[model samples]
Structure formats: C-alpha cells, structure tokens
Target chain A: MNQIAQEVQHQTHTRLSEVSTEDLIVDIHGLKKYYGDVKAVDGIDLQIPRGTIFGFLGPNGAGKTTTISALITLAKPTAGSGTVVGFDLHDRNNIKKHIGAVFQEQTLDEELTGLQNLKFHAEMYFLPKPVAEQRIEDLTKMVGIHDRLSDKVMNYSGGMRRRLEIARGLMTDPEILFLDEPTIGLDPQSRANILQKIKEMNEEKGLTIFITTHDMEEAESLCDQVCIIDQGKIIVQGTVDELKNSLGNDFVIINFNSPDEMNLAMNLLNDLPEVNEVKSSGSVLHIGTKSGSTAVVKILNTLKEKVEVNSVEIKKPTLNDVFLYYTGKELRDDVADLSDRLKMVGRKKGRRGMMRRR
Target chain B: MYASTSKSQDSYNGFGIFTFIRSIWTVYKRQNARLINSKSQLISIMIMPLLWLVIIGQSFNNLLGSSNPLFSGNVNYITYMTPGIFVMITMFSSLFGIISLFYDRDSGYLKNYLLAPISNTAIIFGYAMGIYTRVFIQVLLILVIAIAIGANIPITVGSLTAIILFPVVVSFFLSGLAITLASRASNVETFQAIIMPISMPLMFLSPILYPIKALPDYLQWIAQINPLSMGVEGLRFVLLGKIYTDGAIIDIAQFNDHLAIFNFALLFLVGIVFLIMGSKTFLNSLYK
Candidate 1:
C-alpha cells in the first residue's frame, strides 16, 4: 500500500512539473474548423510556450485567421478540442479574460477618442476604474501614444491608430496578446516602431505574444518560435535554427557555364555522403551540406570528375531560405489543386445549408 | 507572466450579477456620450417628433373640424392625435437604432463586447436600454409640448405613472423587433432593406393618425392587434379625458379600466417576450 501511494505521488509530481516546465500558453490538438466542405483549418496541433513571442507565418488562405477565430471562440471547431491560457476554448468567457487580440480588421470606435476607446474596453472586460486608468496610462506610454489619447481615432494616423489598438488590447492585462498582421500596411519606420513596442511588451510584462505575419523578416526578427502554414495545413514549425537546420546548416551555390554541366555536377555532388539536398535553377546549382568547409573540397572534386566549376559562393541560412526550401513549386501546385476541389465541394454543401435554412 | 498589472483585476474577476449590470450601464453611458457629442444630430432627431406633431396633427385637425366628433373630451382632435404622435416618434427612433447595430457589427465594435468576459445578456440589454433611453428623451419632449399646448391632459399619480411607462413599452418592443431583424443582417444596406418595408405596416395599420372606431371594422381588428396601437390607446387612457371618436364614447379611461388594462398587459408581455427572444438569438449568432 505504501509503495502504491509513493508511485501515485511520484506520478502526480511528474505531471505537475511537466506542465510547469513546458508552460504552454496554448495547446491545440487536431483542431479542425470547416466552412461547409472547405477545411479552413485541417487537423492543426500547436503548443505555444508561455512568455514567448510566437509567429504564425502563412500565405493568404493558409488558415491562420481561421485557427485564430477558433482559439478566440469566434468560430467553433468542426472537430477536436483545445485550451488557451489554461482554460478550455469552450470556457470562452474565462478564456477571454486571459487573452487579448488585435485583429486584421480594425475594430476601434472611430467616433470616440483613443482614451474613450480604451475606457470602453476596460468596462467591457469589467476592469475597475483605478486599475483601468493606471493600466491605460502604462500601455499608452508603452506604445508611445500618450499625447494622442484624447484625440479621436478618425483623426489619428494609421500608425497611431494601430498603437492605440495595441494599448486597448492590453487594458485588461491579458496573459497573452494575439496580433493578426500588426504591421501589415505600415511604413518601414512605423513597422519598426510597432515591432519595438512588441519586444518591449514581451520584456516588460513578460507577455506571451502570438502574432501572424506574411513578412519573413518580421518573423525572423521577432519570433522565438514559428509555424509556417499553407492551404489549411502547417508545413513546418520550430525555432529559426531548427527550421534552417532542417535543410542543412550551410549551403553552397555553384554556378556552371552550361546547363548540362550543372546537371552532371549536381548528380556527382549527391553521391557525396556529406551533401544533404541539391537543386538546380538554369546554370546555377544549389547544394545543402552539414559541413560547408569540408563539403566544398569534396563537391569540387566530385564536379571535377564531370565538368569544371565556374564559380562557387557560400551562403548562411535564413528564414527566406527555410521558406523556399520547405515550400517549393510542387507543394504550391498541390495546394492549389486541393483548394479548387474543396471549394467546389464546399459550394454544393453550402447550397444545401441555404436550402435547409430557407 | 508576472502579476504586473493584476492587482486591479482582483476586484472585478468574480463576474457577479452587479458587475454585469455595471457593464450594461457603462455601455449605455458610452452610447449616451456618443449621442450627446453629436449636437446637430440630436437637434435634428428632436425636431422630427415635434414637426410630425405640429404639421400632421394640425392638418388632420383641420380636416376633422370641431364638430367632426373624433374625441368625446372638450380637448381638440389634435389632442387625441398627440398620444399617437408620441408613439410614432418613439417607434421611428427605435427602428432606426438597429441600423447602428448593423454598423457596429460590420465596423468591428460589436466584437469588443463579443470577446469580453461579460455575458451576452449584458450586450443585448446594454444596446436595448441605450436606444430606449434615446427614444425616452424624444418621447418626453413631445409629451411636454403636448401638455404645454393646453392639451393639459388630466392626470392623477397612477395615470401619470402609466403615461410615463406607455412610450417606454412601445420603444422596448420596437427595439426588440430591431434586434431580432438585425441578428441576420450582414450590412447596413441589408438591414435597412429588411426594416424599411416592415415599418410602413406598423405605422399605418395602427391607430396613429386615426382612431380605431374611425376606421372600418376589418382595419379596426388590425388596430386592436397592433402593438403600437395598444401603446397609443394606453397613453390616451392615462393622459386624456374621455376617449372618443365620431361622438362614440369609448370605455378606454382609467375609470372604466378592464380593456385598457388588458391591452396594456398584452403590450408589456409582447415587449418582454420579444426582448428575451432577441437576446437569445443575438447571443447564439453573434460570432457565427
């Protein structure tokens, strides 16, 4: 009996430690949201760690917004379950208390002043007067819009409006902030300002951020973790290094004088044990390798057997390269074909729904 | 995350009924602020009710001269028409308020409430109460002007209480009707198209410009069933002298009270039922 009791205690302790150690702010499993027969979000599973800046990088129609809508309880999942900020998604009211969001579509009351907009949100969230005022001050200052708080949002610049929206989202002191395209239409300077504020928020409040962006540079600089989604599916997800390392750590681009030489050289390089992947565009051949310094000599020797190497250039890994590596032309074609078929099916299903309702 | 700004949240985290009520009140107050800030629009809205009163009431009175016997009281036909005008103003305002609901939905303002910890009941109630409050102000102005015009309609405390509540009942039901219609509309144009055609029947088929007895028997049935007509007749019973049309003494006063009470009860119940239905439909479909 004592041994059994000890085992149960040990198990309970292990479970608690695991939860705290990983500290997921969001945990989704097989979360599927379908609009008729079009699977907008298809069996997506993600675990976002606490107090980290997470990025969702996707092309248009990639289910980023659909996944967000499900998480925020704006749309119900067709299948599966999830928890956000430790509360079940179905426990929407409780879950809402712990999360704040800035959507792609602007929701500010344009007729009202910035301060009034924030005040309105504070009341909606039931924040007490004193707390609301103080936090309002802090957030406005943090976003660098303290002076324009009294001005109507209609008169404010787009950057100022975006900043005010950020301030308003933080009024309730949410544990996590979701920003859907926070800097989509901003100038470079405005984009930098917003990014800087996001970093400061992560540092000062230790606030976990879940941001979605199409900009690779934004994701590369801001996110501690990223998941790239395409056509209702996650293609790849990991830290920058992990994703870059997925296609070898170092890449060498070998330009040949002839297309035939490039093909022959690519085949010979693939025979080398150190080379990971190879691709050719016109007369240029790109090679992925675990060890560029050691592989370069072997690659040159391999090419020397078939043809002469015209020029060679060594390149570092970047998110752009990671994206290109993961989502090639074939994958895009597959997504387009699947999307067309699904949309046709969706229209038929949707017509039935309209008929039933009518 | 550390509890950087969480100390303030402690007071409001319980989600109590009082807090919900406060949420309703605060939302209404902000709506009030928006209305108050628009001075030109407020004046324009306030002028419409009185304009209908002066123009439509006087022309109808001229058409039905003193001996036309549309009212039993010493008061003129315009006085008999006053109660209907008050309800008419409130009705128009109530219907127009739904356009703003559609605006809020498309504009993303409704999402602030949808994503909040507060109950959906709070949002529906907040919007309902806010629009009613606006209607109340316009209805009150018309009432004061009617009384000032020597249509010094007789009133005791009980009758005065009913008079105050009569327009409220109409506005509440109208606002509920708006909410129900607006729940399915995707844009202002769609909502306006839906609401416009419905407004004509509610306005004309009722006893607004004419009395129930003045119309034919079949139309009188419609007037009797009309919610706005119920409100107009209820208001007349409370604020005017003997109710009459065409020298026929109608038993609609507080002195002879059963039918009036029944109509009042029916209007009140319809108002409440629509409100409840509207609230349920709104919560279910808000984010869908």
Candidate 2:
C-alpha cells in the first residue's frame, strides 16, 4: 500500500511536468483585458508551438486586434501574464527584440524611400549600419520590392506599400512575427503575393508566425494550427485536419430510388449498434459511423430485402463543416459585402489623406 | 542552404559617448534633410520668421515705446524686443514639434520606436533632441535676420552660447510636454484643440512682448508664477545682460536691491523644475 501511494504520487508529478513543458512558444494563461465596460479579451488561454503558423480567426470587434496588440506589447494586458520568446510581455523592451509585428495599419514613412524606411527600422533595432544595409537589400529582394528600393514610398502602389511594411518588420531579424490582417483589403494578386512571401519566410527562415484573419480559407491554407475565437473566447483549436477529424468518422451518404427506400434504410441502419447517426433527406440517406466499410456492407445486405439503392458515396468532413459544428454558424455568413468591407478596411488604414494632413 | 555563422563579432573600438552623440547627429541630419528636401516649405519657414521680425517689429516699435525706465536707460525698442522675439520664435518652433509627435502617432511610426529594443527613455530623448535641433536652427536663422534688419543684437560669445543652450533646455521641456499631450490624444483634432488654448494663454501670460513689471500687481503675480515667463526672463537676462526685477520699478536709491537675486534664482529653478516635470509626464504617458 505504501509503494502504490508513492508510485501514484511520482506518476502525477511526472504527468504535471510533461503538461507544463509543452512545446509552446507563446503561452497565454487566463488573459483578461477590459476596456471600461467591455471585456475585450475575456479569460482566454492560448499555446502556440515554435516554428508553427498559428491563425487567430474571428470577426470584427471580436477582440482579435486587442489580443494581438497585447501580445506584441502595443497594448498592456489587464490581468494574466504571458511570455513571448521567454520574455514577459510586461518587459516590453526585452520582448520587442524577439518579436516583430506588422500592424493592421501601415506605419511606413511615406517621405522616405523604401530603402530608407528599412534602414530607419534597422537602426531602431540597434543593427550596425553595414548589417542593416545588407539586411535591407536581402529583405527588399525577398519581398520583391528590390526594384523600387530607391523610389519614394508615396509613389508606390498600395500593394507595394504593404510589401514594404512586411519587409520592414523583418529588419530586426526576430524569432517570431505577428501579422494582423495582413491581406485584409488587397487585391487577389497582391494578397497571393504577400501570403506566398509569408510562407517562404516561415519555411526558409524557420520563423514562427502568428496570423490573425477572418477569412477561413486563408487560415486553412496557411496555418499549421487554427484557433477559432468568438465573443472573446476560443471555441475550439486544432490543426485543420485534426479539427475536421474530431467531428466524426466517414459519412456514407446513400441516395435511394424512393423516399420509402430511404425510410426503410434508416429504419434498418438505426437498429445496428455500429451506426452512430442515420438521418434521411428526402430520398437520400446519410449514415454516420465509426466504420464506413462495415456499415456500407450491412446497409447494402439489409437493403437487398427492402428497396433498391441507386447510388452511394462517402464524404469526409471539411474545415467548413468543423467550423459550422463548433460555432453553429457558417464562416461566410457575416462576411460584409465586398465593397463595404474594403471601405471599412481602408478607413482603418488611414493612408489616403495622410499626405494632405501633413 | 547557408549554415549558421555563430562566431561572435569583435566589439568595435569607438568612443561610446561619441557614438551616442553621433546617433543624435545622424537623426538631426535626417531631420534637416527632411526639412530642406521640401523646397517650398523650407523657404516659407525661413522667410516667415524674417518677415515677422521686419514687419511686426516695425509695427510694434512705436506701440512698445520706452516709457518704462528699464528700456529708456539702455536701448531702443527694437533692441529690447529682439531677445524677447527670439525667445518667442523659439517657443513657437518648439510648439510645431508637436506636429512631429502627431504625425508619428498617426502613422504608427511611433510604434516602430516603441517596439524597438532600445530603452523608452532613449526614444523620448532622441525625439526631444531632434526637435531641439530644429528649433535651434530656426533660432539661428532668426538671429541672422534680426542682425541684418538693424536690430541691435548682442554678438558676445557668452550671449551666443546662452542662446544655443536656451533652445536645448526649452526644446527638451516642450518635447516632454508634447509627448504627454500626444500620448493621451487619439486624433489630431483633439490634440490641436487642447494645445491651442494652452499655447495662447502661455504666450499672453509670459513676459514676451512687454516687461513683466509693466503689468498690474495681480497680473504680475500671475506672470511671476508662469513658467514661460521665467524662461523669457532668463533668456533676456542671459542675452541682453539685463538685470531682472521682481515687479518693482527701478529707482536710483534702490539700484543696489533693484536686481532681485531671488527672481533670477527663481527663474533658473523653475526652468529645471519644468524640465523634470515634463520628463516625468513623458514617461507616464508612454504606457497610455
């Protein structure tokens, strides 16, 4: 009895240590942010692994910006604490060295040329002049802005400016980078170009990237893991495949010849212990189970006595289905009209009338 | 793939103080490049102060007659107003430094510095130094114009050194105040609204256009308490070699005590206090 108790205590300690030492590059625990009456980030916990692209998905006013801002030291977290690259967020100066951020809004100096802007950023990071020049050259080329290095940023296109901003964030040679809605209002070509560059940076440079977006397709394509947040809480989080697989096993969809056949198939499959859910849509039958092959065999063998089955197909779950299951709402349901969303993003950017204001 | 080069580079042998000063110098160089690169604006900025010295100085010459014993004893009105106007121009140019903070905040360029690995105090000092350099240049240009316009300006080395140091201190003071205001302000409109009232009252209350002793007793008390008034008086005392009086008209019998040592010390003490207060406000505003 004494030996058993000691073994149990040792096992518990080892398990607790394993849980605490998870491969989390950014560990946020019970983070709560309040803006007067609004709890912008309400008791949220997140863990992102090193060298993985983590996507934060949420709609507007869902605390995505606030959370990112707090992580990057642009805003202070009101309650709990977190560490980025082993430095506390409250130690902003130390954490800044390890993290680079591209804000939702542009922060480049239009009066300066693209090269000059990068140089300015490099100097701010205390990079020596020669190293800064070389890094600037490499980054501008990486972002495909090398040709326009000498051109004033004011003369560049919107896509060009966005690219420059991303390249500027790399001047510090940070271990982790945060991109907040990086491609919110860009044209498809520009968005694709930016996304490709981000991918190359992560793959080639081994940089950890934290991307926040409302676009499900972007998250599914770029992220190694996706965390869906709603009303300031993370509803679910997992890799794209893991999240989809968590929903259920393969669904064998059968379209019968008649409604009576579908009803007959459902009645037969419902009694089988292997079949989890059997629902009929008109003449169609959807049989969800742990084993698709075995369930199909049973359904067909039993259907031989009832009615003829015209066609059957098995479909795996998708990110869309996973999102729908977790949030109980379609991903694109609240997506603003294209032009209206563009206008809203543009307003937040505040780049159009900057020169006039100065 | 290029393997990582983990070899540490030797620390360069350079004067640390010189490197720090050079950093500030480079920033000033960029500021000058930015200012001079805009040809029309640069020309207008230089011409505006010269034009003000000529036009406004001439118009206010008669209105600002030497009825006061302080001016009648030594120099003409233009000579008397030259140092005062120089200090006023310094104050105005320093106020324009507010726009730099505003532009940085709006463009998110300020965040670039805030997010840098450097100390927050360094960021504050760098910006303050940049604004101070610009105001000093403007002050220099105004002094040149004043000299050319037959405004009897002192050319002593002591006065020149004082003029240079005056702007440095005043700019540091103003930049600290500007950073505090800019940090709390969400937009340019609210910033302008708050600064305008503060700037106007400070100008009126300070001894910029007239001697402080010329005001009523109650107004004198207000001016005595105003920080800008102390700054103006200190600048005058330093540049014109004028004795500072504490709201009392100078008479021959009272000449020994006419120059109040207490008021001179008060002015210097207030300037130091404002600088400390401004820096404290700046650091507090950083997190907000």
Candidate 3:
C-alpha cells in the first residue's frame, strides 16, 4: 500500500507541474449581459491560453464589446463570472492591477502632451517616476511614437493618437492586454504598422493579446486562434488552419465550352460519391470534394468524351468562406447599420430634447 | 533577460493607498498648473467676484442698511454682503468640480482614470481636494479685499481659523453635492437641468443676503434648515462677532460655540455620505 501511494503522489506532482505551464490567462465561463430587453452577451465561455494571440471576431451587435467590457471589469456581467490573470472580474480592484486595455474610443487627454498622458497613467498604476519614465521611453520607441512624445495629442493625427493609445495600454506592463478594434479607421499603412507592433509584442515579450475585430485579414495573419461570434453567441472557434480544414477538402473549378454544358457536367459529376457540392454558373462548373487532383483528372477525361473543357483551377478555402459558412451571411454586410441607428436616433433625440428644454 | 525580468517585477509592485494619494496630489498639481497657465481666465475669475462685492454691495446698501431694522447695529452693507459673496464664490468653485467631471466623461478622458488600478474613492477625494484648493485661494483673495474695503474681521488668530475653516467646510459640502449630481448625469444638458433647480433654490433660501431672524417663521425655518445658512451664519459669527437669533438677539459668545460645533458635524456627515454614494454611482456608470 505504501509503495502504491508513493507512485500516485509522483504522478500527481508531474501532472500538476505540466498543468501550470498551460494555465489560461483569461477564463470566462457562462458570462451574460443584458441591455434592458436585449441580451448583449448570452452565456459566452472562452479560455485564452497564456502567451497566445487570440482574436475575437463577430458581426455587429454580436456581444464582442460586451464580452471585452466584462473581462476588463468595465461592465458588470448579469450572470456568471470571469477571471483575468487569475483575478476575479467581480473583484475589480484586484483584476485592474493585472490587465491593460485600449478602449474603442480614444481615451487619452487630447489637451495633454503624449509624455504627460503616459506619465499620468503610469502614476495611476503607481510606478515610480524613474521606472515609468523608462517604460514610457521603451513603449514610445516600440510603437514608433518616440519623436512626438512632447506634442499635445490634439495636434497628432488619428494614426499617431492610436499608436500613442497602444503605448499607453502597455505602460503598466500587463501580462494580458485587451485591444478592442485597435485599427478600426486607420489607413492601410497605419493599420499594417499597428498590426506588426502587436505581432512583435507577442513574439518578443511572450505577451498574451485578446484582440477583437471584424477584419478577417487581420485574424488570418495575426491570431494563433480565432473565435467567431454572432447574435450574442459564439458559433465556432479554432486556429485559422483548423477552421479552414474543417470545411472539408479543396475544390476544383472547371470552365466548360458553354453554359448548357456546365449543368450537364455538374449532373455527371454528382454521380461521384466523393463530390460534396457541384455548382454551375454560366460556363463554369465548381466542384468541391476530397482528392481535388484525381477528381479534376477524372472530370476532364469524362468531359473530353462529351463537351470541351476550357480551363481548370484548384483553390484552397479561405477565412472568408469559413466566416460565411458559420454565420450564414457575409461578415461585412450591414455591420455599420448597428451604429447608423445610434447616430440617427441619438442625435435626433438629443437635439429635440435640447430644443424643448430651451 | 535580466533587465526585462527586473522591469516586469517592478511593474507588479501595484498601487497602494500611499501611491493613490500621491497620484491624487499629482492631479491636483496639474489642475493648478492649467489654471495658472490660463492667465486671463484666472484673472477674470478673481476679478469678477471682487467686482460683485463692490458693485452689488454698494447698490444694495439702502436695502441692507440699519434703518431696515433687520440690520440693527450692523450698518455697512459691504461687510454684510462679503460673507454671502464669499459663499457664492465657494458655490461657483465647487460647481466647477462637477463640470470638469462631466467634461472629462464626455471627452472620454475619464475612461483612462476608470481603467487605472486606483480605487473609486481615491478619484472622488482627489477631485474634491483639488476643487477645495481653488476655493481656498479665492476665499483668501476675498478676505484681503474685504479688509481693504473696511469690512472688519476680528484680528484674533481663533477668528482667522474660523474664517478659513468656513470656506473648507462649505467646499466639502458643495463638493459632495456636485459629485453626486455628476455621477447621475448622462450628459451636460441633463446635469444642468438637475443642478439649476437645486442650486438656485438653495442660494435664495439660505441666509446669504439677509439675516435669518428677519424672515417670518416659515421662511426662517427654511433658511435655518439650509446647509448654506449654517456656513454663512458661521462666517458672520467669526467675522462680525454677531449672534444668530430667531426671536431676540442671543448671546454672541454662546451662539458662536453652538453654531461652530453643529456646522462642523453636519458638513462632515454630508461630505462622507456624498463621497460614498457618488463613488458607487460613478463606478456603476463607467461602462454604460
């Protein structure tokens, strides 16, 4: 009995040590939030592992911001709880010490110089002046804003302000950083620069980033794992390659001699059990199935026996298709519509109220 | 690698009470810097009140003169109006505290403070202290002008202490009220709508321009109940050696002792309650 107990204890210790290495930096369980009658976030469960770049993708009104707000202790969750860096979200005072956030809006003081802005934040986190100064210098250099540190933020361009905002988020040297649509309205070059800095932060410092965006290209290039949410619920989540592979084998598209021949080709190709979906548009017959090369060779050989084949192409699935397959709609469709109502209603109500009061 | 680890460890020495206090002090210093930087605005804020003291005080002299019977032995209207004007300055300065808060919230700068590791209590107290500092300077300037204009304030040190404490107490009272209003305000318009009624009524009902005893029983009850009345009366007792009475002139010496203790306790309790409620509301409204 003594010998058996000793062996079990050794195994448990080894397992515990391994588990510590894989501990999640952010663990959210069954979190929910409601805005009056609208359920903004309904029961979201997510686990972001330490030292990984995680992207949260969702269409408008999909509760992405609500989830981020809950995680950062900005908004209270109506149900369930989440932990950031092993600190409870409900216990805001403790959780605030470990997490840094850049909000959707520009949260910096526009009237203050960049250096002063950083200094104020640093002081709030209680870093000594010398330490904060050094960190600020390093952060400015990292974000490529070191040259404009003395200029007031009001004088800076949108891109410059965003870069400074990112640097401000890093002032506390957080283990987990949350960036909500960090590159929303920037020009292409500025967006690319900001994305590169985020990548470098993850690579060099081993920092865990939880970034939310609807930009498919950004998630494909930057995130190690991506979760797609729609209608206040997470539909699917996995690495980019895993999600794409889950769509099932590659596809082969063959352009026929005529539009009439395309339907005939699709009809013939449907007989093959390996073929998943065969769609014909105009003179093109698009076939999605396993073993693309073999299917293409067989289809070409069969087509030669009947009609002519003009061109053949094989392409891999992309993140765009993955998004469409999960959400049943294009990601970009009517996203700005959510904010459009707010702009119209908020302004009209505000104006009418003001006039009546006056 | 060594440098990086050291930096990371240093960053984790998170904020405590002392650090929070230091941060508030830094914010207070910055507010003063901005006030001083705007030379014209600073001069105007100081001059406008002195202007009121001279012009309005002189214009209302007949209405406030001893022939009115309410004035009795106190003939000078400037001295009578000085404390009221001082209270007005205090009201204006404290009201700025809430306006600054609303501006910060609208412009999104408040988000940075909200996300910081500091506690909500720290933010409320810091802002209150900062506003009180401005009120302190304004009160001092008014005191100097009052002395120069022949409004006699007792030269004794105890009387000076009471005069100074008067503004601080009024500041605490108004700061609490301002923060409470600021926390509930969704926008500047909403805030203005809410504060105007409260501030206007409180100003008129208080014993600022007139002594409480001169009013009828019902109005006298309202004036006596007003928090501003306690402050204005306390200031009068300290400066002019006057006693507050409802029917007859009470002993000046005994009235001073009673008013001092009562005002101090009331202001302190109100300040604490306002700070707690304001902080709680402010934290809840942070994300919404």
TM-score of each: 0.85, 0.79, 0.84
lDDT by residue for model 1 over B41-90, one digit each (tens)? 58877887778777887777778746675453565776777778878887
**Model 3 compared with the native: what TM-score?**
0.84
* Chain A TM-score for each of the predictions: 0.78, 0.79, 0.86
Measured by lDDT, the strongest candidate is: 1
Candidate 1 chain A, poorest ten consecutive residues by summed lDDT: A1-10
Model 3 lDDT per residue over A244-322, tens place: 7777768898887888888777777788777888877889877998878777777777767777678899877888788
Deviation (Å) of B143 in candidate 3:
3.4
What TM-score would chain B receive for each of the candidates shown? 0.88, 0.77, 0.86
DockQ of 3: 0.40
Give the winner by DockQ: 1
In model 2, which regions exceed 4 Å deviation?
A: A1-23, A249-317, A331-358, B1-41, B65-74, B181-183, B213-217, B242-288
lDDT of each: 0.76, 0.70, 0.76
Name the better of 1 and 2 by DockQ: 1
Model 3 residue runs over 4 Å out of place are A1-22, A34-37, A88-91, A249-258, A268-275, A281-285, A289-315, A333-358, B1-20, B26-44, B62-75, B144-150, B153-160, B213-217, B242-254, B285-288
Model 3, residue A343: C-alpha shift (Å): 2.1
